[model samples]
Every structure is written in C-alpha cells, then in structure tokens.
Target: MKGQSYSSISFATPSPKQYSETMLHAQQNHATNALRSESKIIPACLPTPNPSSPNFASRFRTDIVQLVETSNIHKHSDTCYKYWNANRGDKKTCRMRMPRKLVSNSTIDPATGDICMRRSDPWINNFNDYLITACRSNMDIKFIWSGSDAKALVYYITDYVTKT
Candidate 1:
C-alpha cells in the first residue's frame, strides 16, 4: 500500500478571529476582576488612598481602572451579579455570588448573531470597560517568589495579551 499523506486528516484549530476574540474575552474578564471586587460588598472594603500592596484586592482594583481607560474592547456577553444573604449552614463563607443574567451578544437577537453597537444597551460599554481594566491588574499573581532576595525589586506585568 502507498504511504498515507498527512493532509488527509483534519484537526480543529481556532481561526484568527476566534483566537483574538478568546484572548480579548480573557483579558476583559481578568481586567474587570478588580472593579468587581471593589464594588462587591463581601470581604469588606479597603481603606482610602489604597496602599501599594500586592494583595488580591488592591491589584484587583488597579486592573479595572486600567482597562476602562485603554481603548481595547474584547468579546463581551450579558452578565449580572446576584448575591444571597441566605447562608448555607454547612460552609464557612455565607455570601453567595451567582450570575443571574444570561450570556448574550451586544445586540441580542434570537435568530441573528449580528452585533449592532448603535442599537445595543449603553451600560454594556461602561460595565465591560470597568471589567477589562480590573482583570488586567489582577490575574496571574505568582510573582514576588520568582526572583532572588537581591536589592532590585522586580515586578512582572503582561504587556502583550496572547494565547498559548
């Protein structure tokens, strides 16, 4: 029998558009974590002037602010926050944060997947921008342990948002 050609098989890889969209979505979500954490009532609020700490909450807040100011809009879907004071007796954490809203496009349509910015809701932009900025400052905080105990204070930040 003749040798089989490698071209005969097909593998599913995301297209450029899909890849870009995915990266954007991830960046947006991470960026917004800061704002969401701040806005959230749980874990208590931090004191004013916001100390330059590497803590989750501090970094979280800074990230959201950056995303909003930067002119970068990624994939966004309808999402909402629902909190219940009704504590689950078993768990230590009483507060429950759930997504009460649906995940839809900028312009929601049953049959069509067209995103019309002009006709879409206004809150979408403001809220999303907030999120992106928050996420940028909050994700992948495995630094501070990466370097030696030398004099130089090293800080790590992701400038290019790309997928592996």
Candidate 2:
C-alpha cells in the first residue's frame, strides 16, 4: 500500500526498445554523432551541457555509456571478502554486494509487493542514465518500498552524516 504510488526507474542495461526509441529520435532529429578524442577517459567533473541541442539525445546516450563503462563497473577486491571466516563456516561474500543477480524483466510480485527491476549485466552497479549524465559520476540507486528499507536508508544517512 505504501509503495503503490511510488514509481521506480529500471535497472541494468536499457532494453532494446529503449535503445531503438533513442535511435528513432536521433534519426527524426537528424542528429549526427559527435567526434571524440582518442582517449576513452571522461573528466571527473563535467559541465552540464545543453540538452536542447539537435544532437542532445544521441550525445546523451553516448555519454551515458561512456560514463557507466568508466566508473560503474564493479571489480572485487580484498575488502569484498573481509567478512569471510572459514573456521566459523561463514560463507565468502562481498560486503558491498557485487555481481547482483540478473532479472530479465522488471516485475512487481503480486503477493509480496516486492519490486524486481530489470537487469542484464551482473557486474554493473545500479544507475540512472539521466542522473549519471548530469552528475558525471558513478551512482547507486534503490527503491525504498518498505518500512525496513526506509529505516535502513535513514540509518545509513545518519551514520554517514555523523561520521568524523
């Protein structure tokens, strides 16, 4: 009942329909691909460029892909398995969960009211194309559908803000 009015952005790679829609818009607008430097690296900070330009949609798609590739892909490190304990029979797992389980389609469970956003790539963190493009940085977003989720989010924010 609490989450009924709230909408969520989809997860993982954009669906083929989304990609095709972008392509169609680009074609309709006669947008041409802009040239880029040989280096694939994007600057850490970027100015918010004009979104009204004729090539905005096409350029936006390109920028989103580049930004995600450069920063959003997860790679496991020593810290990932920091909690593992063989003696105690604790299973090896990443504290910051990486390689999330793939969901082929976005769905809301009828009985439980759980939302599963569509996901394709396992190694990529959750991101919104528009948010990542505007901030020019990596981002992680999740829907707070239940009381437990809201509590966890509040705790996380409080802990982060109170940290020295």
Candidate 3:
C-alpha cells in the first residue's frame, strides 16, 4: 500500500497444517505480546480486509456504499435493512429519496416534470455494468461466509451461482 507504511496483506486461506504451526509458533514466541495474540488472529480460511494504496478509510466507505447499493438492487427495499436506493431521486425507480428538485448534475424530465436520474450519471452507469456482469456470468460465485452450502450465500454478488 502506497501513501502508507505496510505492504499488501493477503487473506489467502492457510492450510490446516500451516495454521497449527503458526499457532504453536505464536504461543512459543509471542506469549507476552499484548497487541497480537492467538485469539485475535483470524483464521486464514476466513475472509480478511484488503487495505489499499491511499486512504483506505475513504475508499472503504465508498466500497461499503457501493455494496449497499448492490444489495438494495438485488434484495429490494423490504428484504435488506441497509438497502440504499440508488435511484432515490426519481419517482419512476423502485426507491425514492431526496425531495429537492434543484439538484446539480440533474435534468428535468419532460414527462414527469421532475428532476430525474440522467443517463450520464456515473453512479447509475457503474451499477448497471455491475448488474450486467453479475447476471450474465456463467461461473459459480464464491462468497466467503460461515457455511459451505448455498444457504450461506444469501447476499452473494448474484443471488445464485452454478454448482455449490
């Protein structure tokens, strides 16, 4: 990661043998290290954070917002509690938000006579591209979660993939 101190920290799953070895080594060598301990160490099999090159905080926030938007798109309003309706400004869309008509980077719809989501909006276009990729893909989607079966992947990138 640039503009920061650390390098890339991979979250690739560690084998069971490697895990046990790491645990044993940690116990023998770092028994007194307060910040790090066996308990705080996440298993390599579990998903981990990917800190980035710049301000991870800002990028992380954006990522979270995108994830919520994706969720709202896939799960719809009643299904997800944190669903953020990306098309909130337009009444024609499923979700509605912000009552202001004088928003910047917006245009008045001739039909509705209200400010509507423009075709040039980056947010809408990016989400549309994501939707297309998710829907048209042929491969099985792998979600890092607690269970190994289909039931565990409720919020998967796509609702479902191929063979579980």
| Every model: Cα RMSD to truth | 22.8, 6.6, 20.0
Rank list by TM-score:
2, 3, 1
List model 1 lDDT by residue over 89-158, tens digit each. 4432312122122333334244543322221222123233233333432221111222241212332123
**Total colliding residue pairs, candidate 1:** 14
- Candidate that beats the other on lDDT, 2 or 3, i.e. the better one: 2
Alpha-carbon deviation at 32 in model 1, angstroms? 17
Best by lDDT: 2
Task: Compute each candidate's TM-score over C-alphas.
Answer: 0.17, 0.72, 0.19
Clashing pairs in 3: none
- Give the number of the best model, judged by TM-score: 2
Model 1 regions more than 4 Å off: 1-54, 72-124, 129-164
Better of 1 and 2 by TM-score: 2
lDDT score at residue 106, model 3, on the 0-100 scale: 34
What TM-score, to 2 decimals, does candidate 3 have? 0.19
Once superposed on the true structure, which residue ranges of model 2 sit more than 4 Å away at CA?
1-11, 16-36, 39-43, 46-49, 162-164
Clashes in each model (backbone N, CA, C under 3 Å)?
A: 14, 0, 0
Per-model lDDT: 0.32, 0.67, 0.33
